[model samples]
Target: MKKTILLLSVLFLLISCGKAKNKAILQGKVENEQIAIVSKIPGKIVQLLVKEGDFVKKGDTLAILDIPEVDAKKSQAEGAVISAKAQYSMAVKGATENQLKQLEAKKMGLKEQYEFAKKSINRLSNMLKDSLVSQQTFDETFAKYQGAQAQYNAVLAEIDEARKGARIEQQTMALGQQDRAYGALQEVETANKERYVIAPQDMSIETITLNLGELALPGYTLFNGYISNSTYFRFTIPESQLSSLKKGQEISVGIPNSDKKIKGKITIIKQLGAYGNIATAYPDYELQESLFELRISPLDLDEAKDLITKTTVTLSL
Candidate 1:
């Protein structure tokens, strides 16, 4: 009777093992979206605003860098803008008061010479008719008068030019220079702004790689963190289970050791290639020869928001 009892116990154990092997429950993990914050400009970290594990909001000031080069560039740009503006103003306005005064004085001198020549020509004409002055003398006097008139006209043109403002093309060229300088100033200012590292989105600080007074290089990661909204679930399912699953199909996700249940949608299903090695994310599961991946996004994100990455969870068929 004791031998029979032992045999019954062995048989029961074998049956339980077989049933456990045939179970279809899969193990998956919650995948959190992680990112590395990097700096575009290289400089010494002057201030660190956030500590590890601190929650940061979008557009939060993460750190400040001391970049002397950027400061110098900003000053240079400011000077260039000032110079351009002065040039533009000069182009728009005519000559100075002193220049106008000098031009008028020269015009007056020419007018006086013209008047003197005219009087001489009149006197010479009267003398020539009276035969007192030779014909050649009268002709010379007439030429002097013509020369004086030409000189006076040239001076008048000069005065007009000095009074008028700059030409349209000149003004346009100065305006272009001013615009280009302004654009450069804006560019430098933007670069200076980048020296202060700002958080791109809401996330938790995982690790701060650099400390105050440490040199930060361009494109070097300063902080490693995770975005809250990018969390998802990844699972590897056997080929036999792929037939029941499809993209955009609604499925149930359950947490072990907890009563939490979340509705997830099948966002991706990829079959492995022939002779391909299965890249299992969760090492707790025994991998099969023919495997497919099922990537699911939670429909109720708030329900699964607290789940950490790599924590095993169950997926319902």
Candidate 2:
């Protein structure tokens, strides 16, 4: 009976253990920071500043492109700024007195001719009223008077426009065109700076895909650099056992066959990709499927630097 009792207890513990959950371990690559230097515009790579394994700091120039066209556009933009300023100055300073004098003289000459034509037309009209002038002569004089009046009015309008000074509206439009051209030039300069690739931050230069004199196209990738200081673990997980792990939960990581474990905090779990269904053992839980990536930072992981890029480790339950 004692033997039978022991067997019953052992079966009880085994059955209870079957109800517990275990998360499966998934493998993932370790990456901290990767800065990819890509071509901003299509052009031949005129200069390559750093080699593979070269160290770089933030904003350090690495590569350059051969784009004379970009340079030319920048020069044209500078010219536009100067042109706008000149126009602005001219508009502020009104036409000179000498200019006004010449306009007045022209207007007076037109007025004198107009007055003479008006008197001739009126005299002929009176003659027509009394049957003294022929219809043809009266008509000709009337036409001449109309032409003179039109000429006088045109002269008066010109003189008035000059006295009014240069129009601010016209000047504003001209200045705006110049400003837009300059703005386009600034954009080209920004793209040109990228031609000389700069380090986004202090990083370990990883790979150099091309050497000097390579024809680089827009969006062509040349190098991959990783940040030197920031380190984190990447975990790949299967569809099943994902729910067993949650962000903010503490995890135990240990070397293979070792009893010592280091604590790590889970930071991110991907909601997409491979996934598993909720435990069917619980009748009330909804069934869902998805894949995920887990990220964690180790506690007191100063020694983690040496173990970084480690291939073997187990996730403890």
Evaluated with lDDT, which candidate comes out highest? 1
| Backbone clashes in model 1, listed as residue pairs | none
Model 2: ten consecutive residues of lowest lDDT: 277-286
- So what's the TM-score on candidate 2? 0.58
Candidate 2 residue spans exceeding 4 A from truth: 1-29, 94-164, 235-246, 255-262, 269-294, 300-302, 306-317
Write one digit per residue (lDDT tens) for candidate 1, span 4-80: 99999999999888655544667777887898999998899999999999989999999999999989989999999
Per-residue alpha-carbon lDDT of candidate 2 for residues 86-203, written as tens digits (9 for 90 to 100): 6655555555689789888988998999999999998888899999989998998889899999999998887776667567886676667667766876787786676677777887
TM-score of each: 0.73, 0.58
Error of 1 at 48 (Å): 1.5
* Model 1 Cα shift for residue 21 (angstroms): 3.6
